[model samples]
Target: MKFGYRIIFIVSVVIFFLNCAYYYPFFSDDSLISLRYTQRFIEGKGLNWNDGHPVEGYSNLFWILCTAILGKSGLDLIWAARILGLACSVGTIAVILNCFRKLHVKKEYVFFATLLFVTTPCISVWAIGGLEQPLYGFLLTLVLTEVLYIITSKSFRRIYLLSVWLGLLALTRPDGFLFTIITAGFLLFTYRQTKTNLLTITLAVVCIPTLFLLSQLAFRYTYYGELVPNTALVKVKITFHHILHGAFYTLSSFLGTFVLSFLGLYSLFILVIRKKDLFGFYLLLNIAAWISYITLVGGDIFPAYRHYYVVLIFFIFSIILGLKLNLPNWVHNKLQAGIAILIVINVFLQYNIPQNHRAVEERWEFKGMNLGSTLKNTFPDKTLIAVTAAGCIPYASELPTVDMMGLNDYYIPRHPPANFGTGILAHELGDADYVMTRNPDIVIFDVGNTPSFYIGEQLKKNKTFTKNFIKVTASDRDADYILFFNTYGNSTGIKRTDSELTIPGYLFRNNEDNAVLFTKKKLLKKMSINNRYEIILNDIPSKNWKIKNVLGKNLEVDTEIYQKNGQLTIIMIPKKELLLESLVLEGKD
Candidate 1:
């Protein structure tokens, strides 16, 4: 293929990955929290600091940059952040392609290397998500690419460019400091023979990232009280055992998520076996150091692969260089074919599978309820509604909601305030003329447990004090629980009730050893057991109770139970060895 077509192909692959990113929801928790912070910052709130102390738990530079470009409100901010990530991803790919071209590597090698970096599941997935990893990876790769140029051309301009990229990289992720250290070491060691070039690269490299870190530290001290954030301290306290576990996890993650990551390493191994040169040695050392750093950080291993993808790209470039200079045509062709097949499979999986749709699924399940519509349709527009689920409520309902979560530190005043649970709930409920508690309102307790007497007592007190209280939805099926609206207060005229019951589900568990149980909660009293009746118990049922089917943990049963003298009993003997928690009597109205 022509060099121009290869370049176009690379660019197309990058764009295709960026396009694929749109289908996945913003799955990163840190990204979501950062978005919330960005919204707050744009509203004039300062950086997060604890108790008037300067601490750096999080740096909102990327989010600020995103909000500045995307504007506040709507889902546009997510797209904008993703676009910025895509730009970095595309730039990283371009750097790799250019480096291969400059190195006089074979076109096939360049294409394979570029394909490895672009289509690797780990890199591609994160390139589209709103996170700093892809951007960090890109900047790191660009710095390395610039280093390659500086070494080849000995240009003062390349040195300066390297310094700028290093600075931006540090600003992107704190780990960029390692890149600065390693690069400085490499320059000093190699170019000691040329003092001028050595000093220029060393000074520029040291000052760039150092200045960024110091400025961030200053900001931290001013706002949060410490050089490093409390969050970092908390993370750093894990045991060495956890670190080892994390390393293994990181390895498994590479295998599972980025299938080509291991393949790229295998290709590097092949290159090393063929030609063990200084470049190959450096590639191995870089990979080892990068992997060590990731394992030491003990971060989410899968995500860390995404964060350090630039290192993978660097390795790919080295492999291409090695292959072109040493490997035979037959060997190179076979490797290229294997890599192409891997890329095709990865791309197919990316398109066909909804791997990252969990975020959207959560949002739809939890946030799609029309709080405002539910309220306006049932009550007056002016009626005040207090909700414990504050974030979703405000977005879904047009009416003002007292956020029990204390998000943004908004709460109603109270004297001799209640505990964290009731105090917050009271703060929300006190000013409200109406209260809406969705399924499992108590939060700590579900329908299986008896309702809290204190809650009912408090409601009774409030009702007596105000001489006005009415439960709108009281039936078990009406709403799982009741919504209280004031009959005498300002909310007197408004009335609303939801007939639909959001069925609360519970996971089945078996406390018995070596047994599995599966059952739903709140089963009916009288039920006919037929072949379709599946009973999953911790222990196997008695021989008397025929097991029609034994499929994995589930046991299908066919039995008859008839009420006798106001008592219900099954004819089959209860298994003495079978331990039971609670029986779920199903199929009864």
Candidate 2:
């Protein structure tokens, strides 16, 4: 292969590795939900729920396309989707390299630009994740590159291609409408002399989104009885404070990722001093304007830095302009080397950060466990599991569940709580045979105390059922305790011995008190619980325990234990909630 092709191939492999590493565990909650939606589509359940409520938390076009092509039980759908993203990211690199070569940019500048795109931490991380960002980044780069081409060539054919790309961009992200608006403004301002050609291009671009919106509107009206789904629930109230906060956050996030925003500023200063590179200036202005617009209209801004992927175009042109401008060879080379080093350091720091490592590890373990399979094994086939979302359970176990959050409008008739709390739980558990919570309580510190009080109060006040089920704690990696209230009579009082509960390759420990703990042996070193070690027994019922005082390992307790329904209920209540900073529960089956 030629040197350019070889460079492209290496960059492609690097992008693939970065994505795979980032999404190594593969399926995330977001991807799992998307896959479930696609499966529903395949099953002819319609886009809405069985009750005909409109499902619109997320856009379904991508899911529909994937399901149509890949079929059901192709369980590694996330990997497949990420591979598509990888292809787009690689395509973006090719387009950038080709655009530079065609513009007669310096070979060194072209290589550097390619490197910047390939190693960009923010872009590389998203390329393999289940989000639509990589696809958006690729299409945005391609569309903008074509826009530049159309400006220089002024060819109707190039303009037509631009229109096609604009359509694709809109399909990928709703924000693509902003791109369409900016393009229209650019054409009217720059191509007044060729009014007819500009009009034709603008019309072509407008028609694609116009048709798409109309079809969506029709679907919404038919299914949701409104033009948009969940619009009423999710409102955007933009204030000056919000805009200012968003602007500062967006800039800070961008700088945090690239560290090139500072360098880009210096390069801008150099360009202005030389009075050169008008095209580069225009591209930079366009990017800046779009970024400002995004900041102003911010909704979900946690991952705002991902928006800066569009700046790849501006970065490429600016570097080329720097090379072309009249300056001493040594000065140019030194600046280039410094900028490259800074970028490489930024990428390394961001990718290798301890928090990012933890996130990747956690996501992988959570997705790998197949919670659906566990639920099926633990409960009856006809059991109605009340989950925060219906994504994984339904697809994995073929169980009917009530989504507490009402995603995709699944529980429209039930009208579940807007938030996940007592209200949703109250409604869901009323009819549910068993309750399963990924995290039972919002506050992790006081789980035992709070849940016991809440459940006690609810049971006493409400006469929905006669029996108060016991809390069963199961050991899991992501959650130390899986607390559930089993209503079935098959709830055996038998507590299995440590030897009987042994799983090979997993650590099993049995304390003298018969408490069994399970964990991976490697993670034992990292586990610590400060100075205070307290164990709150879930079997406890009465809260009348008086602590004589903490004597070292054991606390003197004066309390009575009662056996109810052939089960031991012990209450080892703490004197104060804050006296103990950490509490470690020894797991026993």
CA lDDT scores, all candidates in order: 0.48, 0.48
What C-alpha lDDT, on a 0 to 100 scale, does residue 359 get in candidate 2?
A: 37
Candidate 1 C-alpha lDDT tens digits along 1-589: 4457366465657555755554455444345434544544555655431113222434445445555456455545556667776777777777777776777767777776666555555565666656776678777777777776765676668687888777777677666677787777777776778878777866788777688778877876676555655434323434465567557656654654454565557666765676554445556666777777767656352332454565566667665665676677668547746756877876665444333333334332122133334444443444455443433333333343433222222122221223322221112222222222211121211111222333333434443322333232222222332243332233322111221111111112112211212223221111122211212222222222322221221223333545434333333222222322223333222
> What TM-score does candidate 2 reach?
0.66
Q: At residue 542, give the lDDT of candidate 2.
A: 31
What does candidate 2's lDDT look like per residue over 1-589, in tens digits?
1346457557656755665565464334445556665656667776543234556655535434554356554655656666766677777777777776787755666665566556555555556655666677777777777776765576657666666677666666556556776676666566667768667865765666456556666776786676555422322225465466557756665556454554455565566556554455556566777777656654233232555666655665665566556446767546667656865785686676543344355453243235555555554565454344345445564455444344444333244323312221112222121222211211111121223323233333433222333333334445543233322222211122322211111111112211112233111111122222222223433323332222222333233334455443323333332111111222222
Q: In terms of TM-score, how similar is model 1 to the real structure?
A: 0.60
Structure candidate 2, residue pairs in collision: 516-587, 539-570, 540-570, 540-571
Give lDDT: candidate 2, residue 478.
52
lDDT of 1 at 504: 12
TM-scores of all candidate predictions against the true structure: 0.60, 0.66
